[model samples]
Target: MSPTPEPGLPARVRVHEVGPRDGLQNEKALLPFDVKAEFIHRLAAAGLTTIEATSFVHPKWVPQLADAERLFPLLRDLDGVRLPVLVPNERGLDRALALGAREVAVFASVTESFARANLNRTVDESLAMFTPVIARALDAEVPVRGYLSMCFGDPWEGEVPVDRVVRVARRLIDLGCAELSLGDTIGVATPGQVTALLTALNGAGIPTERLAVHFHDTYGQALANTLTALRHGVTTVDASAGGLGGCPFAKSATGNLATEDLLWMLEGLGIETGVDLDRLTGTSLWLAAHLGRPSPSRTVSALSPKES
Candidate 1:
């Protein structure tokens, strides 16, 4: 079934598949290194070009990804895929660099509470911590991606002002980040808020091309918010397979926008994502079986065979 095109939207969208890292980080079942590596390989086989392979955060912080060292080596043979790892600080960056990571991302929060809660530092202090990390990564010829969480609303601090988000976003851009991913960490953003924030960022001299949207489905607005972002010229989107992970720090947050769910909409809209929906769905189902549970994705549920 060919999709009818929508005017004024991007012809192609880059799906930043975060299932391996963001999706699995919060899972209670600790998968082995081989299973994790195979999951990534299957995702790439499904045509996801850029996959966030894993995080280099301390084992004490995120024990699920404690095997970053062992897991990354197995993926060194994967060709034509961008496996960007998450680095929490200088030590995380060093671990990624030691393993020949071509790209890395640093996470940040726009609110003081989340910054202190997640990074154990004030907003300014966290940025200061990332300053050298971003610089060092750039010096090593590795592009840095900055993730700005709580762009719309926060559980600790409600109603994040657009101007405040813009200020922090600019600081990240100035810090030499190649791209910035605006995260709706708690999934409280509406279409109107999405428009306002993107407009404010554009007005503040941040090009739409340099920005990406990461929405959570807590309010069931992740897809709508994502579409609004696409209308506003944001081509890069972050989604997790099977709608799997949430912010471990923010209890109110739900799973991220599912890759299968997002792919359905993009395919229906005639927007090119280059992802094989069937293969991706199969991968999600496979992972779900391993976790001894069913997937949370609506699209996956609808497409999956019914039980007798």
Candidate 2:
């Protein structure tokens, strides 16, 4: 038999930090607006190029994001950084646009069960609703990112089919979305599953380079799964600082993978995240102390220096 080619080098991955928005939103105490701005400032200082700042979801739905109108302008005009927010519908997009939001993300769920619960709309209905939102953004020369939740497993449904995931990804790409972020809303994906999904997405001519992984560390497998995704030539993994965030409608724990942890693994693997571990970990520790709990990331906790 002919010799197989050596395992080629993996592509460089970009970690978009989402901690300031996703990380702090779920906290019961609800961080003050100033603290939220500071959190974002610290993340940018830590060298994160992209950060999902906040969502324009109604205050009744997610009270933590009530300050979106105020926070967006404060963070949007920062020099040399991209801050995108989650806009649920046309109304939300209107708010974001009025705030001069150039980049925004539209979120939907892969499974019908997740869609109904998260957005109170069916899969097709949600897509139909987002069509105008996407169209308007494109017309305005704005960049739009699509988010697909429960690409792996859902709390209500045991496991989602691979075909379903592929279809949703294709739809999002076809909707003029420049990028798609696959979300593990329940945090149940294994390394094998991560590889399989990315492989399928790559095979479908869906441009894996434009893909981003939004993992939840519910089972503590977020970092390991990230390694698998990186190996499969998938870049732009999303992470929240202090391992913060959880889905409101989703049943299981769905906190995001910690930025500090993701950076630790990437650096150890000789991957360039351009994020400073000490500064990030320092911020993580500082935030945790404010929240009055230890962080969930093993890497962050392991490399965490003594608090002075």
Using TM-score, give the best candidate's number. Answer: 1
> Backbone clashes per model, in order?
0, 0
- Tens digits of lDDT, candidate 2, 1-308: 13232244253567888887777778877777877888888888888889888999999998988999888777855788888888899999999999988799999889999899888999989998999999999999989999999999987887999889999889888889999999988899999999899888988888778898999998888888987877777778999887888877775866899887777666666666778888888888888887878888776788777678
Using all chains and alpha carbons, the TM-scores for the candidates as numbered come to 0.99, 0.94
Local accuracy of candidate 1 as per-residue lDDT tens digits, 1-308: 68988999999999999999999999999999999999999999999999999999999989999999999999988899999999999999999999999999999999999998899999999999999999999999999999999999999889999999999999999999999999999999999999999999999999999999999999899999999999999999999999999989898989999999999999999999999999999999999999889999999999998889
Model 2 is weakest, by summed lDDT over 10 consecutive residues, at 1-10
What candidate 1 gets wrong by more than 4 Å, as runs, is: none
List the RMSD of every prediction in angstroms. 0.7, 4.1
Quick one: RMSD of model 1?
Answer: 0.7
Clashing pairs in 1: none
Model 1 lDDT vs. the true structure?
0.96
